[model samples]
Target: MALTSVAVVLPGRPTLFELGVVHEVFGIDRTDDGVPLIDFRLCAERPGVPVEISHGITVTPPYGLDAARGADLVVAPAYEYSDTPSEAVLEVFRQAHADGAWLLSVCSGAFALGEAGLLDGRCSTTHWRHSDELKRRFPRTRVDPGVLFVEDDRILTSAGTAAGIDACLHHVRCELGAAIATRIARRMVVPPQRDGGQRQFIDMPVPEIAGETLQPVLEWMREHLVEEQPVRVLASRAAMSERTFARRFAAETGTTPAKWLLAQRIHHARTLLEGTDLPVETVADRAGFGSAALLRHHFGARVGVAPGEYRRTFRSNERRAG
Candidate 1:
């Protein structure tokens, strides 16, 4: 699938931030950058009617839920948690799932998916504050308050606020390609990928550090992905002892240097696989994996597919044929 169409179900009092995230990622026109144009539709229960959102803010969408006939992706942003979503909203969710449209929820929007029985036997999440409530409401769904977002089968449920961006960009990267996702992310001025989970947000405080940020070192690490990145060398580069550097790195990235480097390598490998016709061995070497077998093992473990298969499905020149 080329991801040509995206329909967002704007329930009453939808949060401006989550709604804006979907619009900004898929609705905004970026064709000049060679990004694919998506058909972004705002379908609501009350179409062409003023729906109050935010604090006395009103957004009147043009299309009703019935109008979203062929959406490739269907999104639900944070809805009022106290109200069980209307039958109309739930119907749209069920239909989209039956149609195999990619379903995503931002923040408390996971409640709607749960009501639609979409989250039954699926892993889902909401805001950490609401994670227990979600689990209580939909006991069959595993509510993980730890991760930023999760993708099981086709449903993607994200934690509060900014985590929605991670989920959307992740879908773009998986379905479109690294190039397209990177383009959208760059325009938004956010990281193309963030390594941390949402546990940092739930009662976790930032530890005071005496040294400067490791941003420069991180930049250097990405640029030198093909080269060896021993933690000792990285620690030395950061002008800190290994112990202090390790602590700072964990606080900043929520992962160790080795795991981060592995992820970067896999990401770089994916980019290479999609954009070029390089042999797998060459790509592995270029991405710092050193050999095709090593690349296959780690890539399959992380991506759930062989490199060749992923390339065939999402080659930069074309889109996946859904």
Candidate 2:
């Protein structure tokens, strides 16, 4: 692949760590060692203005939003918690999307993308803390707080800070080979990839009182996902009436219990698909999906690839590594 230009957009009071992730991955010159280099620039709505950062640093971008108009990729690093994106900035994103440039959001940057209306009817994600607010603010976006990143065609959204690195490297791997992406990860001294998706963050903090009561049941479901347990059985185990359990589960988990379970099952199936030599039938059975056809249906819907295709890709990656 040829060197591509990447435009990074910064909101006022951007999260410094997330911005650094983008800079390290795309901004720095790494072509000396045969790596595919990305021409990167930081852009703001205006040039020559120093934007405040979270840790009291003022970053003055050399270019403005117009710089993103022709870039191959546009990255929006995290904004501050309270920063509502402006319509003009949103237009920059919209225009770029119209031009077929790939748009990516990191952490609270997802919030900005949502405000820009770029994420409408898209599967996107953000920091777990802000995922609810993002969903509430932009009802059109299907906010899946449980995934590290969601790749919806040209738009890619990653969960908070470090997940930005994962998302970026994942893109590199997708465009370049896994060898190139892993080489970059080795140079950066970060894990090439983290096992499991952001679904692991689902249990981070138990809600208070009304929502708190379902934590135990949620944890149980995660632990016993392979079991052939029905929703009524799960509700019975939680010691709540099925109707109450259904309502409370949605309130606390941000999704229905069945959907959550299916997501977990699919996630597990993906892990097996990527990391193991198991057949599709065995993978589906182990993940509680019962049949390869069922695995194909849900896995294609969630991961956007069939289990066999995913396994073949991973096997190709392993061959490259070897």
Candidate 3:
């Protein structure tokens, strides 16, 4: 479905960063770059009323929950975890869900969705601190605190803070295509997609420069995806034993060498498919999958579509959406 309209519910205490992420992705005017204009609405339970967001900052939304009707997407950003939206506010979500609009929650905003019974019988998550509470409050919902976000049945729930960006870009990629999502992510100065499975917290979140142990090795791995990178070779290059390298790699990148290489190869294949006319065999060679058959196996498993089908759909979507 084409997403032409978006509505964000302005809770009593919406965090600025979470609110800003939504506005950045959907509310901005990027028509010069060929992004379709969306009818973005900031709807409040009480229209034209002042609500202090954080640090005494206040905003007055011009529209009421009624204005959210018929929106293609409805968002509930971070609010106090303990706070519950009024029945009137939740009805807006219920109506949107019944209408098949995509619903998303950021951080404690999952509480609002949970209160609305939207998270029930679906896998969802919130911030780690509030995750137990979320599952406790909504038992039927499977809460995975490890991931950055969860999307099921048109509802997306993201972890705290910047994970909202990941979830939003994911939806953008899903509804539009990788091209549009990458465009927006570039404009925002962030990665186009971070796998939802990545751990929310990592010990070494940002790798050090000056050719540190794993950072330089990881850069080389991406540049050389067409080549084999066994753990022993990687450890030898990093001047560590395989056992030490394995531990540090997990701590630093949150995944093993083999798994990370596979992910990189898959993404590189996606980029090639989206931007080039390379044959499947050639693309697979460049992406380190060895052959078309192997590429099809992994790509279809991860992306839920064959390479040709993905390319066709993405190309068509870029043209139609642009």
Poorly placed runs, candidate 2 (over 4 Å): 1-3, 200-322
> Per TM-score, what order, best first?
1, 3, 2
Clashing pairs in 3: none
Tens digits of per-residue lDDT for model 1 on 87-158?
A: 888899899889888999999999989999999998888888999999999999988988778888789999
TM-scores, in order shown?
0.94, 0.65, 0.89
lDDT scores in order: 0.86, 0.77, 0.86
Using TM-score as the measure, the top candidate is 1
lDDT of 2 by residue, 203-240 (tens): 54543334347668767876887787677987898777
Worst 10 residues of 3 by lDDT: 202-211
lDDT of residue 94 for candidate 3:
88
Cα error, candidate 3, residue 117 (Å): 1.0
- Name the lDDT of candidate 2: 0.77
